[model samples]
Target: MKKILLNLVHPDINQSVVNKRLLDGIKDLENITINNLYQKYPDFKIDAKVEQKLLEENDIILFQFPMYWFSSPALLKEWFDVVLEAGFAYGGSYKLADKSFAVAVSCGGSKEAFSETGKEKKIVEEFLYPFEITANYVKMNYRKPYITYDAEAGLSEETLNLYVKEYVKYIKEL
Candidate 1:
């Protein structure tokens, strides 16, 4: 199995419902390293060398977070800026080349709300284009994103349970 680096980038995961449940379901699985960014870097001071080392060790990099205003949380952006600097992830070496990069995002709105006819008037995939392009630029295989809609609004117990199972299965497959 490919080793997975699960980067959980929620700003306040302790208070999260959907993201918390998803993490709980997959936390104990083998070959999966869970790195909670907010917990690790509370002051937002990320260790680029350590993060680059983790990237080198893992075959698959999966970013798990709740959607914040159609994009990832602030730290994740900062992580990219600091860790994926010149001579490492790009510019020449391309350390992350050929690795698999994917996202598992929890959205506050419903699926319809992210569509053309919906309130947002744009598809969720459109908003996720930057990730795909980033993966391509770094020469990583960009997989289709996994999304859980209506995450903030909430889901029934049974539905949440099902999503947890599905999330675990997805990670295991990767």
Candidate 2:
């Protein structure tokens, strides 16, 4: 079985529906670590060594978060700065090479809003290039992100359940 570090980075997961359910749906899965960043480091003091060690031990690194201002939550970026250092994630003797990297991001707008005829005038993939670049930089395999559009007001209980199942499947397959 593949070991996944499902790093969650939501400002307030209690107020979240999609991200929280997504996390809960996978609790019983074997070899999956649910690392809630905000809960762990509310004061923004990241333990780089421990985070790096988690990365080293996992077969896949899955970033789960709500898209914030076209990027990840602050702590995820902060975690990146602190943990993905030389001789570990990149630079000489990098360690993340060949592992699978993926993201499950929730967007506030509907799918149409990101379409060419929609408000943003761009696809969801456009906002995820940074993750792709980071994955590529570390020589890890980058997969297409699993996006949940209109996350705040979107989906019924049935739809959310389906999405959660899909998310679980996505991680297991990776």
Candidate 3:
């Protein structure tokens, strides 16, 4: 079985209806390490060694976060800066090479809202290109991202539960 490291990067997961539920749905799964970044580094002081160790240990690195300003949250970006350093993730042995990298991002707007016909005038994939670039640079296999749309639009209980299951399934398949 592949050991998956799920890096949960919500700034305030407790108050998040979508992300919190998704986290709860898969927290008990075996062979998966759920590292809550915000909870671990509330002061924004990241331990690069510890983070790199986690990357070294897992077969898959999955980033789960809400799309903020068409990009990842601040801590996730900080993680990219500190953890993916030389001699570890790139420019040397490339520790992350051949490992699978993927993202599970929740969007605040509807799917249509991200299209040219809608408000944003661009697709969701356009916003997620940076992740692909990073994965390519590290030589990791970039998998298709799993996205939850209309997250801030207040999904119904049934819809939320469905998405939670889908998120779990996506992780398992990864």
Candidate 4:
């Protein structure tokens, strides 16, 4: 099994419903390393070298977080900005190629809201284009994202439980 680097980012996970549950379900799984960014870097100071080292050690990198607005939380973007700098992730002599890069995001809105007739009226993938592009640019294999709709105040207990199982299964498969 490939070593999975589960990079989790939640500004306030104590209040998260689905995301927290997802974490609880998979926290003990084998061959998986969980990195909770907010807990590690409360001051938003990302250690680029350490992060790069983690990236180097892991085969499948999973960026798990709740969708903020239409993109990831601020620190996640910051992680990219700092850790994926020249000579390590991209540009000269650097290509994090062949690595599996994917997102496991929680969306408070329902699936319909990402459809043509809904509120955003744009597919969820559209919002995730940046991640895909980044993966491609680094020559990594970008997998389809994992999403849980209505994650905030909507998903029922049964549905949340099902999603937790699904999430664990998905990560294990990867």
TM-score of each: 0.97, 0.96, 0.97, 0.97
Tens digit of lDDT per residue, candidate 1, span 1-174? Answer: 889999999999889999999999999999999999999999999999999999999999999999898999999999999999989989989999999999999999999999999999998888999999999999999998888999867699998999899998888777
Whole-model Cα lDDT per candidate? 0.93, 0.90, 0.94, 0.92
**Residue 84 local lDDT, model 1:** 91
Q: Which number leads on lDDT? A: 3
Q: Candidate 2: RMSD over Cα atoms?
A: 1.0
User: Model 1 segments beyond 4 Å from truth?
Assistant: none
User: Candidate 1 has what TM-score?
Assistant: 0.97
Q: Which 10-residue window in model 2 sums to the lowest lDDT?
A: 146-155
Task: Report the Cα lDDT for candidate 3.
Answer: 0.94
lDDT of 2: 0.90
Report backbone clashes per prediction.
Answer: 0, 0, 0, 0
Question: How do the residues 1-174 of candidate 4 rate in per-residue lDDT, one tens digit apiece?
Answer: 789999999999999998999999999999899999999999999999899999999999999999999999999989999999988888785557899999999998999999889999998899999999999988899999989999856678899999999999899878
Per-model RMSD to reference? 0.8, 1.0, 0.8, 0.9
lDDT of 1: 0.93
Q: Per-residue error at 113 for model 1, in Å?
A: 0.7
